[model samples]
Target: MINKLNKSYWENRYVNNQIGWNIGYASTPLKTYIDQIKDKSLKILIPGAGNSYEAEYLWCHGFKNIYVLDLAHQPLDNFIIRLPNFPKNQLINADFFEYENSFDLIFEQTFFCALNPNLRTQYVDQMHQLLKPKGKLVGLFFNFELTEEGPPFGGSVFEYNSLFKHQFKMNVLEPSINSIKERQGKELFFIFEKKS
Candidate 1:
């Protein structure tokens, strides 16, 4: 079994500033998706939201009802400091699997690859449970091999399809045309709506 990815494990990664997954800004693909979204009040969740630039971007664009959840307090605190007027209640410092809430959308980025591969199915189940009926789960997924050596463990289209096809309507799972230069060919942009 992979080592425990408990709260402390994540907290320490934050405390030490070892979060390479943090892109320091809302990813391009996600920002593009947000730009086209018409609703400003859609309930949205960004789990494993490290330094949540996406949430900040959403807020700046008039989107309320945005929830940013992370296991560590550090990033949440940072977010609070950065956006003092943002609702403190929306900055959740909690485990994703245990948090009980539903949302119209969940934005994914780097969170999936960070977990131990053993938890992929659990992650799927939790996401399915947390989404409102017909809710969408949209984001980028890595398009590489899955291995034991990472917080950024990789995955491919085949693996993603095998894992998520039963529970989600695969709306768009293809090479992201607008990936940032650093991730140009390494990711797949996907829009998966929850199955009713």
Candidate 2:
């Protein structure tokens, strides 16, 4: 049976150091995307941001308004230790579903895959509600068959298209050419802009 996805489950993963989803540093695709962004003042958020290397990278690159939220505190604590200068107020330990705020951009990594499949529609809606008009939700999604047993649940282009088409203008949703070796061809790099 699939394990219950909750704060305890994620906290236990951190407690045991079983975070295989962590790639140790900011992902190359996201890093490159961030590099092209000229605006340092964008209001950014990373929900379900476990050991958020992306947020670290953004802050180090002069983006001051970045926020990181996770259900557990351990990973956020770890992040705080690594970046002592990162604003404490921006590091939130909260459930993503309960988080309420609008941002100019949101970055997705393993967070979406970590949720229960039944929450997919809610995920899309929450994303829509969180973004400012014409803002974007961008990142990688696993490209495989969805099954009953997974926290890293898989999905396909068709499934993504059907879920996001109404609320976002799908800009790109294709195989990630720069994914880490293990995820190459098994992930899609997407940019979905909230419909204005």
Candidate 3:
């Protein structure tokens, strides 16, 4: 399953326009979180960032050090067309595991669930590795039972805690009160600080 979710598979998703996960704008929970940030110079990364509207929102709001990474190239191309002024060097198209950089903050949108469940441990480890000490990983996760079938897989809060607790300090992991209508009951908002 992990092998099948490779670069070509995701590129094909874009090519065929089957990007059901593209919500077309920054998610409200993330935007609200970004609004409270007083420091505009922190380096942030959005992995698996397909047509990253959150990056667009951040850039517009004075967060200029944001980096958007995706395995598929098509979405990054689309993003450049939308935000022509965004620095091209910050737009990365590479395997997340192979990419190396420490970020002060990393935003997780649909990226986690879209990965094959088999790779969740590696995902956690890589996230820990890529975060600066005391750096944060924040954003949303789907609230539902995990099953065998899905690119949009699901998990409970309990499951998430078990997976991330060893390496991250969970500052907040709860049903998001401020989620958009379509995601109101289906999202878990989180802020996890990488352990020192």
lDDT of each: 0.93, 0.94, 0.95
lDDT score at residue 105, model 1, on the 0-100 scale: 99
Let me know the TM-score candidate 2 reaches against the reference structure.
0.98
Error of 1 at 90 (Å): 0.7
Q: Give the TM-score of candidate 3.
A: 0.97
Residue pairs that clash (backbone atoms under 3 angstroms), model 2: none
Q: What is the per-residue lDDT of model 2 for residues 24-116, given as tens digits with 9 covering 90 to 100?
A: 999989999999999999999999999999999999999999999999999999999999999999999998988999999999999999899
Best by TM-score: 2
lDDT agreement of model 1 with the native: 0.93
Clashing pairs in 1: none
Each candidate's clash count: 0, 0, 0
Question: lDDT score, residue 74, model 1?
Answer: 93
TM-scores, all candidates, are 0.97, 0.98, 0.97
